[model samples]
Target: MADTTGTVEASQPGRYSVPGPPPRPRSQLVGTGFAIAAGAMAVAGALGHYMARRHASGIDPGHDWLAGQSVPNPQLVYALITLLVSVVTAHWAVWASGRGERGHTWVGMALTLVMGLAFFNMVMFSLNRMEFEIGSGEWATLAFAVTGLSLAILIVGMFYLGLMTLRSLGGSVGRDRSTPLGAAVFFWDFAVLAWAATWYVVYVVK
Candidate 1:
């Protein structure tokens, strides 16, 4: 009864639980930006594909002024799917990064960033091929060569990042964090590969 409360509190100093690391303000801001961008891309991809399909079909859909590209329907659909998946996973990664689990988010975002650029280029190449009926001449050949090299590098980068992320999970660096960022990274990696395959079928085979 004499100072019993004080003795109990002293024995369990952390009974109230220690607070986690403070939120990284700058990192959270960047993460939010990435999430917003990803959401925008998702919406854009959906709308753009619908318009493109309508344009090709000559529906004259009013909301889709940018819809009427000459690209094949399947390719447009593939692109839409790819972009949507990329955006969704990217946003998830960003959210995880904002919560202090950065390794997976970083890997995922880096993969998407590089792969997104390549995807953009492939889209342009497809547009030229479909709209202008451009054949695989010297320029096209060189472009494909570079794209192939870049794809190789991209695959290697993804593997390296994935391995590093997995390693970090077992180490002290990532031990304090709890997020499924690694899953997000793997998701984006799959999306990239799927996009590459779709591009090959849509552009290269044509």
Candidate 2:
């Protein structure tokens, strides 16, 4: 009977064995990723068209692109800085949620929300103070269109963040339930990047 006891125990149906690692939690992250990619492509296309128009119509001698329209550079700079800070807060929220730090997560989300609102206000102020009307000319129209698209995207991201924040309040944002928070952060970060590009092209390049 060479190792009969070991063979008998191994053959038992209910005998215990070393457990493997826990299964990874399922999430909607993949779907969110696809959506973010599509939104980014749309923004890129709009920016590309705007740049092409600027080069063709604004660059030639005696053909001013802005047509003497004044862009509020100071306000735009503030808005970009606000958005960059929001990026940090948004990531902070995700990080805290992953570690089950509910208080820190709430603080991070709240700060990000406040920064986002401030940025929106600054953008609106800049637009209101601008001398050029949206219907002024081709250049004016394209510029407004690009900036307006960025605002719309930012609004969507804010909406996502709001919903996730509400979910967090209901105790749905811990280590095992952080997927929604992560998705919101991803979209908000995308919004920030889109606005950064828009700021660079429309404000800096002009």
Candidate 3:
């Protein structure tokens, strides 16, 4: 009756049939990071979208346009989506951790993907493609390069993780499957560190 494990043992009320090492209890840091990411995005996305909407003198109100422009700015919406997805992944990680093992690869992959899209597509691309342009500034150029690199890394990391997940999937089900998922999630999480640090240097602080 667990999300990661689809079965429960009748003999042991709190026991599951999933095989594996005792689930690695996540540190507070992991949970806190996930919560912060989600909450910050929700609040920030709402505020950003609202501001863009109100400040746009020419934006269309009919289709959620911010500046009366024909094109709709789904930037804020995208941020919100990433935040929500991250929240869900964090919850799954916690649940599986509670059960004494990491959850499925689906959960880990989902986390990697959510973070990638948000950190790369939403935050990085938004800054480069929207906030700044090719002729904007020296700093802008640097930002573009760094974000581009992060996105590149994200793509490669996803592919590697995908392969790892495939190998794990070829094995028996249950606890057997959690390790690759955990490893992928862990590696992808490391990608976040690379991404944030790199982008921060190029864009935020430079």
- Check candidate 2 and list the clashing pairs: none
* Alpha carbon lDDT of each predicted model: 0.48, 0.86, 0.48
- Cα lDDT tens digits, model 3, 64-104, are 32222232235534644564455456446534633544245
RMSD each, Å: 10.8, 4.5, 14.9
> Mind sharing the TM-score for model 2?
0.86
lDDT of 2 by residue, 1-206 (tens): 56655433355654566777896655567777887899899999999998887888745612487776556699999999999999899899999999999999999999999999999999888888886776878877988899999999999999999999999989987787899899888888888899999889977786
> Taking the tens digit of each residue's C-alpha lDDT, what string does model 1 give over 2-69?
66554433657666798988864445335534644564464345434433444554355332322333
TM-score of each: 0.34, 0.86, 0.43
Q: Where in model 1 is the C-alpha error above 4 Å?
A: 1-71, 133-206
- Alpha carbon lDDT at 57, candidate 3: 23
lDDT of 3 at 123: 64
The CA root-mean-square deviation of candidate 2, after full C-alpha superposition on the true structure, stands at 4.5
On TM-score, the stronger of 1 and 2 is 2
Q: Highest lDDT, which number? A: 2
Q: What lDDT would candidate 1 get against the real structure?
A: 0.48
